[model samples]
Target: MSTASIPKCPMCGKPRSAEHAPFCSTRCRDRDLVKWLDDGYAIPAEPVHPFADSERDDAV
Candidate 1:
């Protein structure tokens, strides 16, 4: 018989709970959410501006 190891939580170096799966507890889960809400994670991308239909037509 073989048993696979459970992954540690990303926020804290603690074994994950089955209820939380990825996070060890609700506190860690909520902290992750707050980071996302505060823009703690950033993806590199080019800036974009929405154009009005008339403006698009003019450009075309």
Candidate 2:
């Protein structure tokens, strides 16, 4: 199997090492944790309408 190249740290934009996986260092990893705790990032989810299920009765 072929191995993919490691990705850079999202916070610092530095090359990542095997030991750190997606993060370049502990500092960068902690930075991500802090951001998560502070709600710095968000992932949007589909809004649910009150009558959406009834409108799409065929789907169920």
Best by TM-score: 1
TM-score of each: 0.66, 0.57
- Tens-digit lDDT string for candidate 1 (1-60): 223476889999788888987999999999999999999999999876676667989987
Predicted structure with the largest lDDT when compared to the true one: 1
RMSD of each: 3.3, 6.4
Model 2 poorest ten-residue lDDT run: 1-10
